[model samples]
Target chain A: DAGVTQSPTHLIKTRGQQVTLRCSPISGHKSVSWYQQVLGQGPQFIFQYYEKEERGRGNFPDRFSARQFPNYSSELNVNALLLGDSALYLCASSLSTGEGYTFGSGTRLTVV
Target chain B: ELKVEQNPLFLSMQEGKNYTIYCNYSTTSDRLYWYRQDPGKSLESLFVLLSNGAVKQEGRLMASLDTKARLSTLHITAAVHDLSATYFCAVSWATSYGKLTFGQGTILTVHP
Candidate 1:
């Protein structure tokens, strides 16, 4: 079976621009979450969605947002990107809220 | 707020040596997870520790959880070059089981 898959493995954007990263969860998974991993640091939680509802959000600023689709796929959007926004965006999916998660290869975003 | 921390941000071990990575969290958690990430890659789930005194082993790696101490450990035995990677520990609280707060990661390098 396929694991979580993310689109556009790499992306480059300019400051003040916006970018949208997509994720397709594994089959039979109903929960999707987003995380940001800066170079030399561990991943940080961003947002989690279950049953297409926003279940939880992290300490990220309002510029970051995400939503899950009926199919359990998810999209992460970041507006007004800054140089600090250059990092790997990871998407994880699980069969339930507290179950083990499967992560995608992630989208490496670079903001200039 | 839940905070996770890992010591020895970097680990350099010789092949066939054994070592352990420690993860400490500040608040109560419903589950603990261990993940491995290769350079420029996403996370690979290694172990899921659900309860206090839970221990799981796969191949040369073992993970143990001590919820009473709010701590978890990942032990690696007979390390090999292929086992070199960054390891992360994440914790999810009962209130928001879908959101995982991760540690700072430990980068392990095994040399012959």
Candidate 2:
């Protein structure tokens, strides 16, 4: 079975620009979550969606937003990117919030 | 608000050595997860502990959770070069739909 898949393996953006990262969860999965991993640190939760509804959000600023589509795919959008926003954006999916999650090969975003 | 902290943020071990990494969280959680991530790669799920005293092992790694203490430990036995990577521990609340709070990863380097 295909695991979670993310688009644009790598990207470069200038400060103040906006970017969107996409993720397709594994087949049959209905829960998707987004995380941001800065260099030399662990991933921090951004948002989570279940059944195409916003289920939970982390402590991230309003500039970070996400949504899940009817198909269970997810999009993470970051606006007014700062150099600090350069990091690996990971997507994780699970059959449900009660189960273990599988992570996607994250999209590397470099905000210059 | 929840917070996770990992100790020995950096670890260097000789092949065949044994070591343990600790994860402590500031809030109650329903699940604890251990993940491994290679440089420039996404997370690889290792173990998920769902309850107090829950213990799960995979190959040379074992993870145990103590919910009362809000602590989890990942024990590495007979470490090898292939086991070298950054290990992270994350926790999620039952009502949050799997919104994870991750620890500062422990970078493990198993050398010969």
Candidate 3:
């Protein structure tokens, strides 16, 4: 079975631009969550969606947003990107609560 | 807010040596996960520990969780250069099904 898959292995955008990163959860998985990992730092929780509903959100600014589709795929959108926005955006999927998670290779975003 | 911390953020040891990485969380969590990441790569799930006194082992890595103390440890035995990578521990609470707060990550370098 395929694990969680993220799109556009890498991306580059300038400040104040908008970007959208996509993720396809593993088959049979229903929950999707997003995280941001900066250089030399661990990933920070961004948003989590289960059953197409926003379950929780991190401390990120309003410019960052995400949504899940009926098929369990997810998309993370960042508007007005800043240099700090350059980071690896990871997508994780799980079967149920506390059931462990499978992560994607992540989309490396570079905001110049 | 949930806070996850890892001690000895950087560890350098010789091959065939044994070492342990520690993870501590501030909030109550019954589920803890360990993940490994190579340079310029995505996270690979290593272990998922649930409940107190839970222990799991794979290859040269052994992980144990203690819910009462909110601590988890990953021990590497007979380490090799292949084990050189960053290890992260994530904690999940009941309220959020699949949302995880990750630790700072321990970068391990095994020398020959």
lDDT of 2 at A14: 100
Global lDDT for candidate 3?
A: 0.92
| Sort by DockQ, top down from the best | 1, 2, 3
Kindly list the interface RMSD, in angstroms, of each predicted candidate in the order they appear: 0.5, 0.8, 1.1
DockQ of each: 0.94, 0.86, 0.84
lDDT of 3 by residue, A19-50 (tens): 99999999998889999999999999899898
Residues A1-112, model 2: lDDT tens digits: 7889999899999999999999999999999999998898888888889999888888889999999999999999999999999999999999988789999999999999
Off by over 4 Å in 2: none
- Model 3 Cα lDDT, one tens digit per residue, B19-93: 999999998986899999999999999998988999999999999998888899999999999999999999988
Best by lDDT: 1
Lowest lDDT 10-residue stretch of candidate 3 chain B: B92-101
lDDT scores of the candidates, listed in order:
0.94, 0.93, 0.92
Worst 10 residues of 1 chain B by lDDT: B1-10
For DockQ, candidate 2 versus 3, the one ahead is 2
Candidates' TM-scores? Answer: 0.98, 0.96, 0.97
Please give the distance, in angstroms, between residue A21's alpha carbon in candidate 3 and its true position after superposition: 0.4
Give the alpha carbon lDDT tens digit for every residue of B1-112 in model 2.
5789998899999999999999999988999999999999999999989989999998999999999999999999999999999999988887786688889999999999
Expressed as tens digits, the lDDT of each residue in A32-94 for candidate 1 is 999999999989889999999999998999999998888889999999999999999999999
